[model samples]
Target: MTIRVVAKNYVKPEKVQDFLGLCKSLVEVSLKDEGCIDYGLYQELENSGVLTFLEEWKDEKSLDQHLNSSHFKEIFPLLSEYLEKETEVNVYRKTL
Candidate 1:
């Protein structure tokens, strides 16, 4: 089954640009990983500092691999410094 992941991040207003730069690196590398179906980053128009990461993977193993990827391990902790609050990450499977 395909896995979908949505991660919502509230970036500190002063760190939005820094956050974006890091996200760019993260997304760029993540897209090349095996089993990555899709990986995209989105920002809220109404709230520029609010960002979201939408990802799709081939299966549970793929998602787990991604979570354990070098980019994820290195970048996610750095991303936390720019966040105003803890990120909200949710995983789902298509039922329809």
Candidate 2:
């Protein structure tokens, strides 16, 4: 079954724009991955520093592959530094 993931990041107020820019490349790369069905980023309308990712994957195994990818490893450190708190990642499956 396809998996849907929502990841919310509370970024440092000053670095919000920078973080968004960084994610642009990450999104591009992720979307090109074989396992990624869809990937995109969004900034909360009310809170500029809050960023969220809406992603869909082919399956849990694919999502696991994505987590272990080189791009993920590279961006994680940068993301960690600018994040105000730990990222909140919620996963789900579609139901008929």
Candidate 3:
């Protein structure tokens, strides 16, 4: 089954641009990975500090592969430096 992943990040006000730059690199590479159905980043209209990543993967295994990817390993830890709080990530399986 396909899986969808959503990650919400609350960035520090001063770090929003830096956070976006990093995410742009992450998205560019993640989209090229096998089994990555889709990947995108968005910012809340009302809350500029809130950025979200919406992703679709072929399956749990594909998602796992992405999590272990070298780019992810290198970029993810750096994200904490820009965040005001921990990111919130959730995975969902299609129900129908």
Measured by lDDT, the strongest candidate is 3
Give the per-residue lDDT digits (tens) of candidate 3, residues 1-96.
899999999999899999999998999999998899999999999999999999999999999999999999999999999999999999998887
Candidate ranking under TM-score, highest first, comes to 3, 1, 2
lDDT of 2 by residue, 1-96 (tens): 999999999999999878988898899999988789999998889998889999999999999999999998899778888899999999999998
Query: Candidate 1 on 27-94: residue-level lDDT in tens?
Result: 99999988999999999999998899999999989989988999999999999999989999999999
Candidate 2, RMSD to the unseen true structure: 1.0
Candidate 1, clashing residue pairs? none
User: What's the C-alpha lDDT at position 65 in model 1?
Assistant: 92
Clashing residue pairs in candidate 3, if any?
A: none
The alpha-carbon root-mean-square deviation between model 3 and the true structure, to one decimal in Å, is: 0.8
Candidate 1 residue 2 Cα shift, in angstroms, is: 0.7
Better of 1 and 2 by TM-score: 1
**Residue 23, model 2, lDDT:** 92
